[model samples]
Target: MLVSIDRRCIKLLQELEKETEFVSIKSLSESLDQTRRQTQYDIYKINSLFEFDKLPPIEAKQHKGVRLMDVHREWLKDLLDQENKKEDSEYNYVLTQEERCAVIICENVLRNGFSTLDDLSEQLMVSKNTIFIDMKIVREKLKEYNIECEFISGKGYLINGEELEKRKVFMYYISSIYGLISDGMLDYLQDEDVKRHIEVLHKIEEELEVHYNKGIIEKLALMLHFSETGENTKWNFPQKTGSALVCVNIDHVCRSHVYGIIDKYMKDRSDDEKAYICIHLLAGRMNKEYYLYNETEEIFEELAEKLVGYFETLVGVTMDKRGSLIEDLTQHLSRSSYRYIYGINDGSELETIIRREAEELFNVVRKVADRFSHDIQCPIDDQEVAYLAVHFSSHMHRTSAKKYRYSSMLICDESEKKRENLKKRIEDNIPLIQIHEVLTKAEYTEAEKNKYEVVISTEVLDINDGYVLISKKFDNTDHINILNEVLQSRADEVSSLSDDLFDQIKPYIQKKQVGTVRSIVDHFFGSDQNSTLTQLLTRERVKCLGDKDVSLSWRDAVFQAAYPLLADGSINRHYIDSIILNVELYGAYFYFDNGVYLTHAKDTSGVFRSGVSVMTIPRGINFPHNKKIYILFVLASVDEKEHFGVLKEILKVCDSKEKTEWLLEAQNEDVLYKNLRMIAEKK
Candidate 1:
């Protein structure tokens, strides 16, 4: 018989097993950090489980405390050993409330029919009341993916949503709960089907000479298996024809291996089903080479370049290694575009923390993502936006000279691959600490003490000084903890420096000027150094080609708008030509969804100074896509940071229909300039 025991009860049994003689209830309560009454209740629960298994109950005397008989002691020892083994297999670890909620969601999503409350209770080893509470959490979580958990009088709990969304929820929660592909996941799928699907994926990897992220592979396998079994027949995926970039014939080896498994479970193969499988296969691929010949590669490349350029313009920093940044963005966009098309939300677990830690950078990247999404005609969610923020943040950190104040050492007993991955994650996210070495438990003990300022260990260490204990699979909480630790260390350094500087300067400064000096210092160190719209778009830079009797050509209008900046030496003639060249090559990407047409170029060689020239043409100039451009803004930037704030204000006006209309109605230079300045200064 199976027994459900809480961690407290298990600890109580372990304490009894360790003792040769009777132990006091008070000592046991202290050991488990619970009250004596709670300890007694735990003992009662353990005794009840033993009774069900027909084992001797613990012998408890009022004064002498509690003791298990010899037979009962052996029985507990064996049971604990089995439980430990089960924990090692990740099959029966005690579930936290969050994990329980995730499990409930997975169960509801994976099951073909409704899951009864009684069955869930039995499987999770909790009462129906606990399952009910878990269902509430499950419902809220499912709502994020637009899935609904519905309950009927006798039908139990079922997940209702679009098939794609349901699959996304299933993949996300299942991957979170299990961490990686494991035989333990067979509880959600048929054992034979899972094995077969995994076999097919392995074959595909071998044939393609590529590897997929393990979690992605598992999710893909499950999706493929489910699709093959006629479980995903409700919705039809659009068939994509003609591979533009197929370095390796996907139809030969890749299709054969995948179709072999699909054919066994499914007799008929439809083009829509094939397209579905191919889309997932491409999305799950980790190797960049696999996506080289992708049909949308050229489009993604152009989009990536524009995205990086736009990000640079927004964040006020030039990305280091521009080519590498473009390549990475292209790869991410390729996979993300597929996900966007299919409504698969593969967002990071650290999205909330990333947003909080890099709020300014996140906002900047969100603007970039918004532009990228507009270009592709897709809605990019915050999670994906957060991921793009990470890329830009990491790039910015790499470009800047970061001084590591503290040294860190990693102690992990995992394989070298996992240890290196953890090391990379730590270094990538937390730039304050430099990791000196990665040592195992034995290696750490043999080495010197106090060698590193921060000691991060996968397991508990016997060090006298403080150390951070993180899981082997480092999670978001661990990332935040380490980040806080490093940030606090940096803060301490800054605080000490501030104190010393204040002490040195206090005697020379007057009290009246102290506030002013302090404010200046704060602004110097803390400000982003972005220039406002009015600061850049002065009266000299504003121009109006008032309702030309003969409407200028789009090219002439671009040159006419840029002439003011060129005349004032804010920009050279080359800058204007570059803007024209961009339009010639990219076909008016500078055009916004609003009537405002923003013209700029990344080629700063022709830019002499940072300034903006706003020109209004009441007689709109026709452009490609039949877009009539009434208001033209020529931006000349010499530095990355100075133009960001003004660009943000301009984008704000572009976002508001009323603001755009206000600018369009202005007839002369003064009216256009005044209305534009009013709109720019509104916020």
Candidate 2:
């Protein structure tokens, strides 16, 4: 293991290890008592040692001095300890210029210790000019950590900030310079003490039947190593009171094991120590049952439900098993809160995937995080937001898979008993169709049939759409076979329609728009499909209603605005329900800067097709915060891609106050239609 390395190179290695920022060459020259060429030669020899030893190299900056990247401290310790036997070197290390400045400011300024610019230059073996440049770089980096670097005239330099921020900078630099093993760790742990502590931790793991991850192990070791040192540091425990409440409900056995270990290894343990240990246990354990603490259980549960509710509304999907989803999310956030508070980040690689695949969900999660942060009085970073997005996106994908199988409508005759029996039969025999609603004869409208693919009716219908007539006691395999056959035929028709004139217009329209275009083509050109957006736009599908306020509740308002589309079979009752629930859960998130609320849910289970319906409420309905919404547009799109043009068209009209006001106050449908055309032309 012996190697031929210069003593000065070893000295340089020790200096580089202590430096967080880059050091200048001129400073290194003065520190090492060597010429610039000699200093460069020493650095070269050190790089050779680093390469031979397979250790990370010392990296050099252009203007700033050479600094050690995130190098291995333990390896350097072994080398330095080995080198100690041969030489009595007073200049044991030569810190880079940047590292010297950080040390001078942090140790002297941060601690209120005295050191003038001349004193610092002399102590660090750097010229005053180099010290000035180093301090400038340190000032910029401190901003990222929210620490202020200030220098008062007679007072020299001072780290003026909150106590918590100061310690955060201290801890960060401590880690950066020395890696995980710090002076505190080495000083506290004897060879035997380390072995005894590891044994105790292992015993606790066996008792709890839980294994801690590498992160947890390192964190535990570090905490134990610096427990006494940390106590003396007089650090602020802002999260201590909150963390104690969170730990109140942990599993008794897990808590007991943690207590046993904490008592044995960490003497005179404080509340903060116990809470910190509890967080590590909760985060590192594989069992989800141990996620929640007792007192905060209900609080996290409710928060999880509210979050999922907002997510469902934003993503346009119904979340089943709300209880389970809530529990899981609560557990994660609870654990995450502790880490976020202490600035302990076990970074995620899936953050990019979550951001790219579910960008909208990520944005929604960020908003939720912001709101939640306001409630808890803690900042939620983008990484945490991405983590929540992944959870929501996975749940939505599962819910959508089941929903997409078959969205069906069940219609039976006047006989309640017969209708009930047929519903039961269909449920038992065919698993493909998801019956959205079961309607009686009086409530059933002919228009409703258009919303579904194949409707099972006890009475014979005159409808040309997918209609099936079954007997009263239709609980047979034959009925199932017939219903499935009808479904297959309807699917084939949809496929054919999708293929007809879609290829020509696919490039021009969005993926979600393809289905709407297909429907339009089927209506206009029959089997020979051809259609245009202008022709569709000219149709009275886009309505602008008048100011006579029909007094409606928020839920009722959503339905009323959406009723026109449902009546025409552009959307279904489920889409209407989704919009209402969306408004209920996530209030006015979709509202524009103007006095209009665009009520919409995309790719919800109930969107029969893509369409927009506009309704005006002159006597506006009061939203949650007394924000009056005068105009409401219920936008229903079955998929994500198709709605770009639709949204663009709507936004163009809504963007202008004059256009929007005129459209809302128009005397009649004809006037509104003409105004819409004019606005469309202007766009």
Candidate 3:
């Protein structure tokens, strides 16, 4: 039997397998978005369980990080696979206060009993104040579903609501929290009727020509089981109450097939149960299959058009006409609506991958999808959003559109040196435009005014040609405005309106791909491929400070560590805050062993540029959960691939106890830099 473990431990185990090098507390904390202290506590809990179960202990690598010390990695993996094969209910989870409250309240209401705050507090092993807060949150949550949590003075508190709504809330909450099957709930499916019901479902699917997402059939079967079991309990459905639910329009043949199946196990209760199960069937269908119903065809068309429009706006290019991107999106939305309406789960696994690849488009799609969900009263999950992104991304790669390039000349009536400086400033600010020449006042000629695409002059010229007036200063808003005007006009040059949208999205989304404005524009326009990894890993971005004996608070240390990047304008305050936020939420996942903390925000929200900052402390700073860090390496990167080479170099330097110790004992910044260079060179 597998040892009982909480979700955190399970996550730790999963994360451990992915670690190429020794896993750090800071890395785990950031990835898990838990505090370092909480992460350490979880690690301790998991390690203790491992000890109790006589499993190989997770070995600490001194200053590096933690490692799965089992000699046979494959054997350890097989052991984990064995544990996963066990029933989900057999695994125990360390529930949060809210989850505990939900369980307690759900059981109490299902039993048609009242429980005082004091009773709940004692039972859940929390203070009465905590129970009070839990109840308040529960009450607020139930209100959204039109369920009421009534408090009777002498009777304590009991839930008063319609049976169907109560059961909906109950099943939704339970399934969502405990995963697909709960302990008692699993027994319902274990019975013989489950097989027959599945057969009926399969027949219905065959007739409808629609398939369901995996496990959805079981979920629907469980609903029927719940309806039958709840019949014996106080939960009762009113005949009129069924009308409030949007009825799924099953064809006559499919309806009869479903009714025939339900009649075998639930003869008298078939009417209500069949309707309830049909709602679930509708929710889980993976295809649009709108030809079966005329009314839905129009609805799906509208949804598809809206989704396509939103995607176009997001990716900034018209989709290729050859594909069924709209039809595909429509089908996904059709199925996704059920997930939203019924509160079914769509996971974030794919979203993470898509986010890393094309984050700007992901954010746009998410925002647009959210708006659509609001209109339709269905909440869009990131998983569904990611699926949409996949379709849009495919469209993006297969098609091409015309991009604008501006060519202009600067006519500055200033000295040679001043004109040169002004030209560089304009080039830095508006790199998309090619400045043909910088003409001084003495060199000015009316005949050469129209030679370039646009003319930018410091003094107002009385010419009808394309002339933009600007100040003699380096950074002038008038020049920027004139350039923006020119760029905006170039939008019409493209075949699709989305090309304009792409231009609009560039400033917002191109932070990661930027070397300079010209490079960014060229990269976007398909003239240049992406930058090389070596070019991205430049030494100008690397910063280091050494101290054999210095100490600071964890928060202060992180702020101080990030200060160099912040001061240099490589990262904004938001980036620093994001790093701190990750630590606070995820615990010390970034805190590698050996007194080094790898701190960074998971996303590029606050990054002005991709850069790395390093701070060394001999005495070390104290993080939560007894984590002492000697070195702090804060990274701010726009791209996911930013740290690959850096991490490789760092891992080599900190691979062994001897190497990490020697590095820590380095006398000066020059020595540290030399050792770091040597290690990086070896790689």
- Considering every candidate listed, which one attains the maximal lDDT? 1
TM-score of each model, in listed order: 0.49, 0.33, 0.41
Model 3 lDDT on a 0 to 1 scale: 0.58
C-alpha lDDT (0 to 100) for residue 236 of candidate 1: 30
lDDT of each: 0.65, 0.57, 0.58
> What overall lDDT, based on C-alpha atoms, would model 2 receive against the true structure?
0.57
Better-scoring candidate (lDDT), 1 or 2: 1
Q: Give a tens-digit lDDT track for model 1, residues 546-621.
A: 6543357888988888888889888888888988887776556656656678778877898888888887777777
How would you encode candidate 2's per-residue C-alpha lDDT over 1-683 as one tens digit per residue? 54555455666667667778888876776565444544676776677767876887677777687887665566677656654554653323456554564465345423544446787688676788888788777776565556667777896656555544454344334333332133321222335555565666666667667655333354354435433333434434543244432422333433555666665655555544554455555443324444334344566667677778666554444664566567668766665554445444343333444443344456557656655654544445565676676455434433211233355667775566766667755654344445677886667787787787667767666767566667665533334444445535544765665575677777998877877876676655332222122323433555444344455577777777788788888778877886777666667776654677777874467777677776666667777645578778767776553453354356545654555777777766676667766655541
**Each candidate structure's count of clashing pairs:** 1, 7, 25
lDDT of 2 at 15: 67
Candidate 1 RMSD to the correct structure: 19.3
| Model 2 TM-score, 2 decimals | 0.33
Instruction: Kindly give the stretch of ten consecutive residues in candidate 2 with the minimal lDDT sum.
Output: 527-536
Give the higher-TM-score candidate: 2 or 3. 3
Off by over 4 Å in 1: 1-318, 323-342, 346-382, 397-417, 424-436, 439-470, 475-504, 528-534, 548-550, 617-621, 628-630, 641-683
Query: Which candidate wins on TM-score?
Result: 1
